[model samples]
Target chain A: MPDLGLSVLLKGKNMARLLGGLWVALRISLIAVAISLPLGILLGVLMAGKNRVVKAILRVYLEFIRIMPQMVLLFLGFFGTTRAFGWNISAELAAIIVFTLWGTAEMSDLVRGAIISIPRHQYESSQALGLNKRQTYFYIILPQAARRLIPLSINLITRMIKTTSLVLMIGVVEVLKVAQQIIEANRMTSPNAAFGLYLTVFVLYFLACWPISLLARYLEKKWR
Target chain B: MAVKILAETLLSIRHIAKRFGDNTVLDDLSLDVHKGEVIVVVGPSGCGKSTLLRCINALEPIQAGEILLDGEPIKPDGKNITELRQKVGMVFQSYDLFPHLSVLDNIVLAPRKVQKRAKAEAEAEALTLLERVGLKDKAASYPRELSGGQKQRVAIVRALCMHPEMLLFDEVTAALDPEMVREVLDVILKLATQGRTMLIVTHEMQFARAIADRVIFLDGGNILENTPPEIFFTNPQTERARQFLNMFEFAAVKHHAPAED
Candidate 1:
């Protein structure tokens, strides 16, 4: 018989533990996204530089981050680089560092793409209006380009949240990792509870990403 | 309008040539525009009419020539770009109204930032311009909310708010609806009578003929005719000028003469 009373299965410590895991996941995601924003904007601006030498260097860096899988990057940061550098960092901090780097690179390229996609005439028109370079950017270019960037940026933030689950492989106790621990420990003592704990983790991710996705879509429609 | 102080030659260019990969947009172009002179540049597309206007403001760097505004070359060494931009205002073919900004903010930004006008003063000035352009009711509307003519009107006022020594219009009404075209042209004509020095890049022969103090016909990246509008439009010397004017007339009317401006 199928278990129709799955909601009833979660009670007391089991429920509390599931909630705690979700909070941990949320915290990691929030911190990771926050740390990446300014760095991403700076790098993105650099990638849009007109100078060929500077642009080439930025393209290489941006592409490397984009092409590599997040898992390999996590391993390189936590194990390979940490070993190479002779640093004994904790897995939680390492996971944060890796995710921050990955998220920042992705976010910056999005910003660069949005900004550069602005028509060439917009810059010329602003300049013709007698706005020197800096004034043109602050008054004309940036404000216009920013509208295109916001929805894309929010989408990136949600992706960052979803990708935080991969950090569980680094031994960090994010929501999914915590859920795994609960499942293993309580496996023999109520095997069905293991299934309930994983389902709760899945629901938590859905909750976090749902509003963000909705926000991105809403902004897209509204701005259009 | 007569030259009020003769404006001491507001802008002058000498032997300027521009090329992109051996494709010259302007060749040996030279002209001197006085303050308050309404000079209309008319030509076939790709004859470098817009490029010349852009060069006066340093929007496009010219190769192998020099441009002087008030007898000074605009160079990278000049530090007061905001000040210079405050002195020159340009309206574009696309209107280039900031889509995110309301019709009012589009006018107020350059003044508040570049000209250092107080927000209250800038808005007051902007409101007056909007009123002049008949867009006072559209102050709060975004660029996307306005019709093409209304957007271009806001653009004209946005340029005016900078208090430019001269205004440049790069085919300002070329992109508008037929009914909308006259409204924008009306604003420019009104500005002309009010003594604004302007360089207009246009193909509208009727508007050019009505208001242009000086009209220059550019062909093959060279000025084929430089004379008063009456001379250039009525008595075109070059065969090329006659051919080009015919095309413009054809676009506006079905059975137009080839020799008419």
Candidate 2:
């Protein structure tokens, strides 16, 4: 077979650095997800509410996040905010903040869609049966909405993981950043190392996201 | 069985007007339903029969008017609305059973959660109600597992488990298949015989004539005629009421005759 330059990943300390870089990406994303899940759910419910002002405010917020690019958001969080607010925010903290903001907006929309997808008759029937608002959501609405939410949210988690790659633009030194460093360091020894290093990065991403995709598929089928 | 409608009014609707945007559904409609009275409301489609029931249960907000249950006014966002709703149960055209819950859980949910009743007591009551509706064995079944008629009966049982003073049925049998309609209607007929107070909005004329203590004929967002079922069905005063009855009678005639084929 032709030489595909697959040997660079087997070199000293390079593989370990890549793994550490991946963990950095994962840590930021996992922390963001943990914060987003509950906060997003609350915001979702509020977004679905009848209050004109609250709905309008959340509408503007959701639209703003959707309209702005994630890269610009990261730049704003890391560099622009530091200049404007006169506070020193670390690159990792900035990455976490930016990802959490993006994740929350996406997650809340998912929850809002899930909540509104339920038939209006469900709410009327529950109310007629003397269930208070809180009781109705707990006993009837949430349990059903959760099924729709779980599959969609797993998909969000995967997206969040992949999107964490964007944080390297702000100098967070994540997987893609480490892969570039390795490729540069090995340029003289292995001129074809760029191909293998990039290929390894793709494999690492697939390995990280494939099982989650499988879980989402399994749940969607099982619940459906 | 002949129910004795007591002189004391259990529910009183006073000049209520309900509007959706520019369209008026119920305009200046007033009614008094006494204890143990079976008031069946018959109207052309979109004549506000279901809206009236929803307004009474506080599901729909009235643009104008007052509704009193046990001499206390009922408002959509009233402070004691939850407590008031506990005393007034409403079933819908669609069965609207909680799909995620088993029949037993659906029935006992409100009793346990709102009324703060003991779990054993709620389940026992639910089982008893289910048995009365001929659904004793279906207590563990989810809404999707049961037939439409079975689901509607469970919806009724769910409402009854709350021990509401009055029940509202908004075309509860409308969604069932022809054969399944009887089973659901039979349950309502049994409730009427047992002297349960009810306000029923239905198109089942024969059943309405059989069960209603009084019949209210509605049209154009108003009650055109409020009379006993005997008078209302046989000799409706207005030309509008006559035309409405003729349409049903005409259909009934087609129903009994041999198939054209």
Q: Over the stretch A1-224, how does candidate 2's per-residue lDDT look in tens digits?
A: 75566788888988898998888988999999999999889989888778989888888888888899999999999899989998798999999998888888888898899999989999999998888899888888888888889878998898899998898889999999999999899889898888888888888888888998888888776755
Residue B94 deviation, candidate 2, in Å?
Answer: 1.3
Location of the lowest summed lDDT over 10 successive residues in candidate 2 chain A = A215-224
Q: Cα miss at A71, model 1 (Å)?
A: 1.9
TM-score of each: 0.90, 0.91
Q: Which pairs clash inside model 2?
A: none
Residue A189, model 2: Cα distance from true site in angstroms: 2.9
Chain B TM-score for all candidates, comma-separated = 0.91, 0.94
DockQ of each: 0.62, 0.68
lDDT (CA) per prediction: 0.81, 0.90
lDDT of the structure predicted as candidate 1: 0.81
Clashing pairs for model 1 are: A130-B85
